[model samples]
Target: MRKLYVWDPLVRAFHWALVAGLILNMFVTNPGKTAHRWLGYGVLTLIALRLVWGLIGPKFARFRSFPPDPAAALDHAREIVTGRVHPHEGHSPLGALMVYNLLASCLIIGLTGWMLTTLTWFGVEWVEDLHKAFVTWVQLCAVLHIAAVIFESRRLRVNLPKSMVTGYKTLP
Candidate 1:
């Protein structure tokens, strides 16, 4: 086994920050409250920062490190079903797809949320409904993300959650 440094500090910070902001907005803060709006802005800012980092960050932190490839994801799923282990040092193909999914979903949520505060879109039912839909999508994705992480961790014998927390993955 070898310990590889994968996630960067900024990446880890962004992940936790986004998690906190999402939890705050989804549960603790009311939609119309100032705190909720600011939290949403903070989450959006973190995502924007993450997008920039995905272009120029460290090796494993860059999006290029884990391109979204359907073929690769299929192979990964096949391996899982066939009881073959292929441990990835960075984000796996399926995980990369999830990352992109969450990023896009969050972006939509944030944009529609901001639109709600605009004069033209204020009190617009469609915009509000769209925002809520994205929020629900993200919430579902987050749960799936967590479950997949745990499942992959055991399957691959790598602590994925710990890698995100400690910036290192012990690969077998």
Candidate 2:
């Protein structure tokens, strides 16, 4: 196995912070409450920081390194079906799609949550429904992301979750 520095410190911090924020908002804080609203704002701030970091951060953290590409993701899926062992130093193609999806979902959820706090959109049923829907969507995506990470780690002989925590990947 070869150890490589992959995830940077900012990337790891952003990942874990987002995880905490999502968990707090989704399960601990009641929707429409002050705590929920504040957590949503915190998530929005994290997303904004991640967007800027994706522009100017390290090579693996950059948007150019893992641009969302459906075709590439599909190819990756094919590779998985065929049991190919191609290890990406950064986010894999499917992983990139998930990152994009989660970022967009969190942004929409934050916007809708903020809308609910404004006088104009307060008590608006559709806005509330949209926020709830996105919360569910994000939760589902989180499950999928975790499962994929575990599966890929075993399949590729790389400790993917460990890499996110330690900023190093032990790749086979």
Candidate 3:
């Protein structure tokens, strides 16, 4: 199998770190103040780092490569539906959309969460509910992201989960 170093080191690191932080921050409910704050900070840092990485990274990792362009994204999606096996070198259409959605939603989640900690917004019941709702949406997006990965891996006959772990994908 041909091999390619598609994802940069920082991108892969940020991806896994965010995954861990989000997962831990999701299930651990003993929000004894410090733990909750630390988790939010961790997520914020991960997102910030990812933003930097995307700006100055390799071809596939660059924001220019994956910015949400509706026509192209939709055409690629249509190609996939029409059974055209394109030699896709970077993020696929649906994957790109998912990435954008996750990024925007997570930013909102982090902002609202951090806002809740501010003295000005402290004890605001609506902010609390908003944070909780965004967290739930984050979890749902994560699950859907995984399912998409699994489906794409199977369709492409590539072990994408392992590729993310190893930062390498065997090419066509």
Backbone clashes in model 2, listed as residue pairs: none
Q: Which stretches in model 3 have alpha-carbon errors above 4 Å?
A: none
Tell me each candidate's RMSD, in Å, in order: 0.6, 0.8, 1.5
Q: Superposing every Cα of model 3 onto the true structure, what RMSD results?
A: 1.5
Identify the runs in model 1 with alpha carbons over 4 angstroms from their true place: none
- Give the per-residue lDDT of model 2 (tens digit) for 4-121: 9989999999999999999998889998788998988999999999999999999999999999999999999998999999998889999999999999999999999999999999
Report, for every candidate in turn, its global Cα lDDT versus the true structure: 0.93, 0.94, 0.80
After the best TM-score superposition of candidate 2, give how far the Cα of residue 94 lies from its true spot, in angstroms: 0.4
**Best candidate according to TM-score:** 1
In model 1, which range of ten residues has the least summed lDDT?
Answer: 32-41
Give TM per candidate.
0.98, 0.97, 0.92
Tens digits of per-residue lDDT for model 3 on 105-125?
888878888887788998788
Question: Tens-digit lDDT track for model 1 on 1-172?
Answer: 9999999899999999989999999999999789988888998899999999999999988988998899999998999999999898899999999999999999999999999988999999999999999999999999999999999999998999999999999998
TM-score of 1: 0.98
